[model samples]
Target: MDIKLLVKLTSRAWALDILAHLHRGVPGRQATLLAATGAGRTAFGASLQHLMALGLVARNPGHGHPLRPEFILTAEGKAAAAKADAILRAAEVSAAGLLRKSWTVPVLALAARPQRFSGFKAGLGAITDRALSTSLQRLEAQDWVAREIDLSERVPFPVYRAVNAGGEISRVAEAAV
Candidate 1:
């Protein structure tokens, strides 16, 4: 649940979904996982490959036919899967999709309190302004984040804070940290 690992896990669209399903005891066959995650074959395959590259997932040798291999979580994968499950559980089913986005969880994790735009940019390191803006707008639309205008300064600014399900997700993300 290190920040870097969390960022890598979220880099792929379906990686966390795959991990959550695996942690929930779903069979790890490609088809089974594909069905469970509701992910397309190619994207799911890519995410699965990404997980393997991260050493969080590995093929179970001698466990299945060559054409249909079974995947097992490595020890590190189990820990990560647990965190993924916690995150998904914290989010509403509809909002789970936002969690799949690159910056959402990281942003939420940092937004446990109100923050300015620059605060988020500084904390997240490499996120582009457009990406951060899009993620914030989406979360705001979902009512997961609330944006308030700060008029105290000569130049007005917007501050973002996690609310509702977003607050829960932020708690989970902070706990992982």
Candidate 2:
């Protein structure tokens, strides 16, 4: 029931986005989803594979390619996506509540650009280095943000980018607007 537990760990935003899309109902076909999500074929295919592996989606016998097959969400997958949706929604609520005047306003500002820890730290304005670090770490751990470390140098700077997560963010933002 606790949403925090769900957001605590996930691979990436796309993973959650894929789940949210599946949760809408079992997809009839990959082409239908590709058109719905506007995601490229490669991205859609990979996500579909993962969903199937997780039992969130399964091959639905129908007109796919005549040789291969089509896919749809399983009952278990629908249940899982629903759970993920709730947890992500709760996390966003919690995060929004924590916001003050300029506290994290700028990080949200970067909603357009893919940002890293250092860039966000610089944008947060009044937050302490420690606080920003904590927030980013929490977000990363919860699968809200994808962390990438560039080890090209001896010292790596980690970057954080937000994930879609079951369309929770999209739904919440649209509702707010």
Candidate 3:
């Protein structure tokens, strides 16, 4: 699967929530989905449009009154949602939960290239030291990132590198960009 495609699918507001809810395998009416996702009408509509565009979801033309549309997962949608469900289940922190944190995805993406603290600060100019430190620590605790001391350098500085999971996220983000 294209990591970019996954990132693009998940990054939009309410996208994962919609997918997660739909992954339940029950066709849902617009009202039901709106209630289940707790998304505002505008955001829900937008997300639905986006998912349909990606061919992950489709209208159940045979079901529901014309005034109230129903939706179901397409074959590709089911496969993608299944993968997303697995990722969420396997995560120490849910993927959606992690993305909720500011700067988490960007920081993870940069860390994939193996960066020092200073490098992170420089690369993400808007991120505060405390936020960067917290993100790095969180990622390390989750085992998505590895921290190493550079003994070869005159002044040993700590470097953060993305593990396989982090690399996976970075690839997704890269594709989104």
The per-prediction CA RMSD against the true structure, in angstroms, equals 1.2, 13.2, 5.7
lDDT of 2 by residue, 35-81 (tens): 76566777667767766766677887655786457766678666666
Ranking by TM-score: 1, 3, 2
Candidate 2: residue pairs that collide: 13-163, 16-166
Task: State the TM-score for model 1.
Answer: 0.95
Model 3: per-residue lDDT, tens digit, 53-73? Answer: 998988887888888888888
For each candidate, give its TM-score against the true structure.
0.95, 0.43, 0.60
lDDT of 1 by residue, 7-96 (tens): 788999999999999999999899999999999999999999999999999999889999999999999999999999999999998768
Q: Who is ahead in lDDT, 2 or 3?
A: 3
Best candidate according to TM-score:
1
Off by over 4 Å in 2: 1-9, 87-177
Worst 10 residues of 2 by lDDT: 1-10
Worst 10 residues of 1 by lDDT: 1-10
Looking at model 3, the pairs that clash are: none
